[model samples]
Target chain A: MRNLTEEELRVVFEKLAKFIGKDIKALVEDSNENYCFRLQKDRVYYAREVVAAAATNIARHNLASLGICVGKFTHGGRFQVHITFVTYLARLAKYKVWLKPQSEMSFLYGNNVLKGGVARMTENTPKNQQVVVFNQSEIPLGFGVSARSSLEVQQASSTDLIVLNQADVGSYLRDEDHFVGCGL
Target chain B: MDGVEVDLGSLSCADVRPIFQEETKQELEERIRRSVEFLVHGLFTLPEQSSERKSQRELPEPFSVIPRAKPIPKEKPLTKWEQFAKIRGIRKRKRDKFAWDEGRAEFRPIHGYRSINDGSNQVILPHDPSLEPGESPFDLLKEGKRKRIASNRKNQERNKRSLSKNQLPTHALRADKRSSKSLERSAKIVSISNRSLGKHEEGKKSKQKLSSTKRSLKKSIIPNGVERERTFQAVNDVLKNF
Candidate 1:
């Protein structure tokens, strides 16, 4: 990873602020030293780390400074996602559409949500907007974009597309062509 | 009066004889005819109806008036099967009754009354479980059944049907009241213990709530704030980097 100048960092943060609906620079600290780069790294960054260096100042108190932690890496970090406890808790992630229980397994395997499978959705869930898909029990299945408006999805007769399957946690266990990381 | 009839063979009409004050020839003929008819009736029915004749003879009149006879209702005998059904408390249909005895192939009484549906042969569903006392019955929907819980009244109604008519409701109620008093006395001891147990449970519930809240707070939010001041300092120190 290469460090970024203040100009490029400002631009990235500007786009991120719109997506997150908040000023994220105020939420970060400069002394944070964890890696926060995308695949092609270019950045000074802050990241959530479950572990801390023991020689650091106030290292003993770092464990109690945050909320509950669960394993984010599995098989010695060879995989970035674990098999269990994958929950979507991002406050910024908004739009959602739920599928019936019978359609959940196929949906997690990167299949498009078939007709009559939509359980419910937020009113005016606009087309082409990023939406998180959940199961009947509200467990986050993946992130997708609305292929149809919320009204059309509920009222359409033909088996038209409703959501475009993007990334899912189930894709990690079973290799699929469209397997991206958990969008949450 | 004994009518005299002098009838010798070859008597001429010109030789008319009158016994009573100058009777006409026509009157003499009627007298003679009446005399003959009386004699013939006496000969034919005189002995055959001798008992009646004797009684009538005591009466001065010639004939007597007879009284009219009344017709009696015909009685039918019950078959052996009908007797057995009656012995088992089954009876013929009456007004408002709807039960049918399939074994006997006939409509039977419902609630101990005869049925009035004389022409209906349609099958009826068992309404014993579905109906309450004195409630009118109608066709129920095939779905959405409501099941009634068994209760003392239901049991008492069953017992009342099995009981003889001599057993009155007041006697049963008095007996039940006495038994209930005894049961309540016995239950008081157990209820005292249960009341104390409920208090103990409440005490434990409050203690559990306190522990659960503390654990939830520890897992959800920051339990230590050592980096809070330093993190804010670094955010404020962002301008120094320029």
Candidate 2:
């Protein structure tokens, strides 16, 4: 609800650059609370929340980017660090690993990936590297960390204990999963 | 044993048996008696009348291939208002079983009594693979191997030309730079050879300058984490203005 000044904007931008790992070309604030932070004219992140103090700390600490989080207007009442879909996509575009439909379902359900489900992975992907998980159509489904390097995944029969899932778009589609269906 | 009658000739055997065994009186009586019994049995067994046969004979023969009968005449039960409504309803009613909703860009009546399950809508389409970190399908790789088993003679000739160009000494490259045509020819030559030109040629060469120009023109081609490291140094340069 609060507006950020020029000085605060600079701090936010610096934090975003650290988080996004790219130079933010421009930052445009809309009439509403929604903020469009441009990476380029075409590529932009619509940040829903911005807190100058938190952003300053994020930049100072060099914390790994959590994309856009619901920023606290006041200092440290409660921080809602949410990974926005745009950031999800950015991660997916770069650090990607493909999952079979079955693996995709499992990953969406917040289960860790097992061996042999990865249809493809980025070359030179070292073991334990963070990866974006994608479905067969190549849509970025979520994010995870790889259990094995790309070469090991290929050479080794099982990527057992591979790709531990962090977040997935399936969360939006599924309920709390209070009751499971028999796929009836 | 005391009264055994051995002499049957003298005994009255003719009197014991019938005096006239083939007599006409006996034959006529036997024949008359058989005739009377037969007449009585025939009269009782025979049917009195054939009423079914007479009725069947009286009726006309049915047609072997009968034509379908005409429906009975009837008047329309609907009123004028009702008939008009019925005709008006036909336009929409005549529509295909599925009605498309342009607003949603999907079929209307999605939730229906008849339509129990819509798994297609339920299924999530994966993001386009091109959007992911991958080599473009259109990207012509430095392909050493042939796609097909059969060798292309034309390709081989192009390859040979490229090989001959590569054999040319590094200093010889400058001689071809004056004419744009040679540089264009070199690009074609390089592509066919399926190998990277030396690092010196990459810097000094003028052929396929578009490839280099594009590389320069594209500021942010790669997205995501890779972009982070590549652009990290540049970030400070850009941020210095602030």
Candidate 3:
């Protein structure tokens, strides 16, 4: 894929900075044949992704931050961008939401990781339907997009990265609250 | 109805009639007499010898009181060991106080030096080598080493005290002996009061911090599309807008 235009790169970094609170140090076109953007900051690879360049122009705009991986090397390409992004999205969707008050909500997390928070499509789309939206702002802050084919029992197989369906989502919440066997 | 007279053969009528009348009267009297005699004999005659029954009925006599012998009391047997142990335990308890004081002192001396020396010396040195008739050269050498160590420790402790002359006696010695006797009781009251004050202060601080945080979280919204910094950025954005 051709390199991202200077203007396009700037706009993407701006969106990223607004969401992440950190400026993009560098942006480079990835060596992979698929069109992916490699975001560099302070000489460290922070995030890299396949820009979904074709999807960007199609107007089916859902900016999906699939997953995050700590860089194993200084050079950006050590990890695959699209796979990592998908993993990150699945991880975010796996976060369970506690129905308790915020004071008790602290139990859902360790080291300030937001563990219990519910995420649903803006329009409550049916199971297996794809949700696309422009920019991350359209999506809830604590919630993220699902890249897999179907979210099953709140569990997406590693091979099949589906968004977790609603019943499974409720089941996860019930299990997390230690009320699994309460016939939820 | 005719007055024709019937006469016996060759008998006159008057004589035959009178004689017939008298004989008839006599015959009737004899029959009546015989019936009377049969009735009187039945009345006088009773039961025959075979019909009579033998007498066997009897009645009980008055009752009398009888005395019984008094029962004897039996002795409860005692085991030899139980009696001996009871007597031994009483005597041992009386003797134990002094032994326990000596044992505890040997077991745990307050000064580390003494405790270590006491333990090591007991293992290495003879209990009372002098009791043996022959005195070994090693025994004298060991005794000399122990004496030197004891003197050196005593001198070092004195030097340490002199160096820290300005330091107050530890809290332990400052309390009077009588007060120290009830140290745990007084310490309990002091600790309880301190803990209560500490808990109250902590509660107040947490409540104040929570209210301020809740207000801030409610007002803030992350400015950009980034997910990571939203919480902190939102707070900052709210503060900036406010």
State each candidate's chain A TM-score. 0.57, 0.54, 0.23
Tens digits of lDDT, candidate 3, B1-242: 02223222222122111224446777866655554554344333523344345432222232323344766655433334445777777443332222222644554443445543444445355457455567754566668778987777655443343333222233523233323224433343333345443345443232222112223321222222232233234334433433
Clashing residue pairs found in predicted model 2: A21-B228, A139-B127
Tens-digit lDDT track of model 2 for B159-190: 33343333333333343223434545555455
lDDT (tens digit, per residue) of candidate 1 on A7-121: 4344444433332324244335333543222111111223343322221223222322221121122223221222222242223445677889988888877788766677878
The superposed Cα distance between candidate 2 and the true structure at residue B100, in angstroms, equals 99
Residue A13 error for model 2, in Å? 7.6
Per-residue lDDT of model 3, residues A1-184, tens digit only: 1222334344444433332223122122223432234222211122333333232332212322211321122243232212122222332232322222441232222212121222322332334332221112332112223333223424543233223222222223444543221112
Tens-digit lDDT string for candidate 2 (A2-50): 2233333454445444323332542332135433322211122234334
Give per-model TM-scores.
0.29, 0.29, 0.18
**What would the TM-score be for candidate 3 when compared with the true structure?**
0.18
Q: For model 3, what is the error of residue B186's alpha carbon versus the real structure, in angstroms, after optimal superposition?
A: 20
Q: Which number leads on DockQ?
A: 1
Error of 3 at B181 (Å): 29
Question: What DockQ class does candidate 2 belong to?
Answer: incorrect
Which of the predicted structures, 1 or 2, would earn the higher DockQ when compared with the native? 1
Model 1 lDDT on a 0 to 1 scale: 0.46
What is the RMSD of candidate 2? 43.6
